[model samples]
Structures are given as structure tokens and as C-alpha cells.
Target: MSQSRRNFLKAMGAASLTAVGAKNAKATPKNVLSDDRFGVLVDTTVCIGCRQCEYACKVEHDLPAGNIDDYSDRSVFEHMRRPDHTALTVVNGYPSEKDKQQQVTVKVQCMHCDHPACVSACIVGAISKQENGAVIWDESRCIGCRYCMVACPFQIPAFEYHKAIEPKIMKCDLCYETRTSKGQPPACVEACPTEALIFGKRYELIQIAHERIRKNPDRYYDHVFGEHEVGGTSWLYLGSQDFSKLGFPDLGTKPAPGATEPIQHAIFKFFVPPVALYALLGGIMWLGKQNREEEE
Candidate 1:
């Protein structure tokens, strides 16, 4: 084949592959909401600010876990904290609206949304909503895009900014790989002394949350925090006061990706844009060559 023809063929082949990749990147996976998927119900009202869950999480993930007794320090609760790279979960203390002397503790972690924005935002399918109700991240597939961090409504995904090599997007995975996949509760749930975090089926947890609120209306805020927020979540919450006061975002019933996915699908539907761009580039090359030959 002629040099110009060979070059054209190579360029077209690369463009086609690029186009295919673009289409696949935006393709939404089947939204899985299994009836028997496991979940954790966090009773903020029952938490004691012990921070055992935090310690357990660190140990489980092989992070820099300090002495277990160190978690007994209630002073850490003085300032509100969120989950970060060092700790996948953290407990924060909030003043009880009902009682002046008592404080309510809330364990913060990934909500593992039923319709995860991270999974949808990922350009490389690095994040996935598992059948077991865990929104897990595959480090192997992650290209350090940090889209998951931006997409999360709870702002749960944490990036390892300090690591120069293979920095990770860190968050709670509900022990899917280490425990739950083997039919065991997460390290945090197992460590809670007060049973504040209950691990069970997602549907069952919702039922249990409502039952608690129904039986003790005065103790609960009359709403299960994660039951419907962003189209529900695997990590449910029950609190004494407004969730907003406890540092929870007030989100709507619609899933975070609902507004954007349709538009994305439309744009990438037939891979028309990539193919057109490729063809246009080829035409430009051909025209340039023709003009040069005429002058010669």
C-alpha cells in the first residue's frame, strides 16, 4: 500500500477504537437493587461516641491503626469529622436537641447509594454498585480521574493526595471483599459495643428502621435518613433530631445520575461524533495532499 494510504488506515483505526471507548465509558450499567442485598442501619441516637468503629475500620483496611484503647478518647468528638483516606469511617458527636447534658454520636461513612453517582460518573467503569449493596471501587481500573469524589452526594470518596504513586480513592466498601462477601459483618459493625450499627438485608434494615421509629416516635426524627435520599442507600440512618443538624445533607428522592444519564446516552448513542471527527480529519489530510500535489 502507498505510505499515505497506510497512514490514513492507521489513523482511522485509532479513531474507531477511541470512539468505541468513548461510547463504553458513558454506558450505564444495569442498576441493581437486590431484595437480599446486605446493608447497615446506623442508629445515631444509640451511638456512644466510643469511636470503636473507626479503629476497627483502620485495622481492617491495614491503615495506620493506633491502639484500640485510643478510641475511648471522647475528645476527638469535640470537632466534627468526616470519613477520609486515613479512616474509611469516623464517628462525630452532636449536641442532643432533646437533652442539654447528652450528645448524639453519628458514624459517617459511604452511604453506598442504590443509584450511585460514582458508578455513573466513572469514565472507565472503575466504580460499581454491587448486588450486595456495596458501591465498590476497583483501583486497577481507576485512572485517577477523581470523578467519583466529585459525583458523590455525601462527599464520601477520599483521595490519597499524599501518595505520589498509585494514590487511591478511599471510602467504605462495607467489607465486601474482606468480610461481607464471606457472610460476615463489616469490621465496624462487629466492633460496635452498643449495637448502634446493625448489619442485615437492605429491605429488612428499612423495615427495622421504620419499626424503631414507629414504636418510639419521640426518640426518632420520624424519617429514615437514607431510605429514600438519592433513591435510597444501603447505609440507613435513624437520628433523634433533624439529620441536617447532625451534618447530613438534605437530598431529594431522585437519584443523583437521573438528570445526566439520559443526555449522556443521547450524545454517545450511535458513536456518531467520534466517527464524524475521524472522517473530518481524514478529509482534511486528503485535501492538504491534493493541494500540495497540484502545486508540485
Candidate 2:
């Protein structure tokens, strides 16, 4: 690894550790800072591949509809399309039966990692992990560099490619401003006809997920997607077959993107390193100036 990357990782030590501290500090801040608001829990095994949620997202956000007229069509899906500017959420088809082409689809959107890479990669701090579980970006603060796009491990955090002015990071915010703030679910979850997507407290949802698994372990995978991956996630997944089979990469338990900041903070931000560095530089400059004056 390069020196900068190595230095960054060394500085990020404590924040990356899984070991409990003297006490487990509260994680209820925001998606980036901590888990503040509640989040959605998606059980892929139950998802019916209905795109009502996608249509709802476009309508809620006032985005122009691009490709499909029929929400249920599986044709365009032969190609993998992720969440993007026009489409805040895209359901990808995962072929299950090798011979029969029995497919299962998982809805892709911001996983809303507890340590969101989008929040850290953003230089202007335009994007913030809200006190709620949502990661929100203020367009006014955005310079449109698209670092958030590059930092996301899930490859989420889409940008407004069409807008010439006041463009911003465009992705799911769990409808924090509209639905979640009002104590209602997001447009996508609301539009799901089947109980495919459920919204509630993260703790409660974990319980519900476990119950579903215990009832029918044979029907669902034994693993929970977002629980401990890179610290935790507001959104989670439960699938019947292997997650990889459904376009889900086996990420093992690493925190998702934007995770480095907290790690950065825990190690480097504690001692006021900036102040120390400034002091050191000031001392050096002063010494050099004094030496030059003596020579003159």
C-alpha cells in the first residue's frame, strides 16, 4: 500500500476495531456518525420482484422516468443496472435455478452504512450522516466532485448527471424529509405490495429477522447482511439462496465505505493533531527567521 493509505489506516486504528471499549459508545447519531433514525429491513427471500417501489421513488423525487413504462417487465433486467440518478432504486434479477432460470431479485439502494464513505469522501462535508439513520447531502454544500460515488463500496451514491446547476448526490435517503420525518415509511417501502420490505426500529427488525430464520431456516440463508458488516447498517438483507447468487457480493464483516472517518477521528482527531502540527511548524519557522536575522 502507498504511504498515504498506510498512514490513513494507522490513524484509523481504534475506530476500526471490533473490540468493545470500556463501554459500547452509543451509535445512535446518523448513518455516518452513528445510527440515529430507524431503517428499513429487506428480506430478499420474501421480495416478489415487483417494481412498484421504483415507480414510487421516481414520482416522490420528481425524477424523469427514463427506460421502462411497465414496472413489472423483466426484459431490460437482462443487463445489470444499479441505482442511479434517474432510478433511485433498481431491482436486479438473480438467476436461481440453473436449468429453469428461476430468478430472485434484490432491491439495491444505499445500504446506509453506519460509517458511510460518502460522508467522509465528501471534502465540503455537504453530505452528512443525519442523526437519523439516513445519510443526507445538502446540495448547496456539494461541489459535485463525485468522491462519494468513488468511495462507496456498494457502488451506491449516484450523482445528478443531467443537471447543469445545483447538481447533487442523488440516492435514497430513506425519505428522511418527507416520509420518515412524518413517522411514515419511505415511498419504496410503502409501494411494496407484498410485505417484502418492512420498516421499523433496527433492534426490533433484527428480532423479526431472527424469528423468520428460526421458523424456516431451510427457506432463508443463515446470515444477516448488514448486522456487523463494517460496524452495522440501517438496512439489512435475508435471502434464501447464497447472497452472491443474487448479485450480492460476500463482503464478510467489513464496514462499508465512509468508514475511515470515524476511524480517522478515533485515532488522529482526539489529540488535536492540527493544533500540534501548527505549533511545530510555527516553531520551525520562528527558528529559521531568527537565524536569518542574526546572519543579516
Query: Which numbered prediction scores highest in lDDT against the true structure?
Result: 1
Clashes of 2: 8
What is candidate 2's CA lDDT for residue 42?
Answer: 91
Error of 1 at 51 (Å): 0.4
lDDT (tens digit, per residue) of candidate 2 on 98-194: 3255677789998887877777788788887766678887878888899889887788888777878777688888898998877789998888888
**lDDT of candidates 1 onward, in order:** 0.91, 0.79
Residue-by-residue lDDT tens digits, candidate 1, 1-296: 45798899999999999999999999767547869888999999888988889989998999999888888888987898889999999988888999999999899999999999999989899999888888899989999999889889999999999999999999999999999988799999999999999999988998999999999999999989889999999999999999999999888999999987888778877997898899999999999999999999
Runs with alpha carbons beyond 4 Å of true place in candidate 1: 1-31, 286-296
lDDT of candidate 2?
A: 0.79
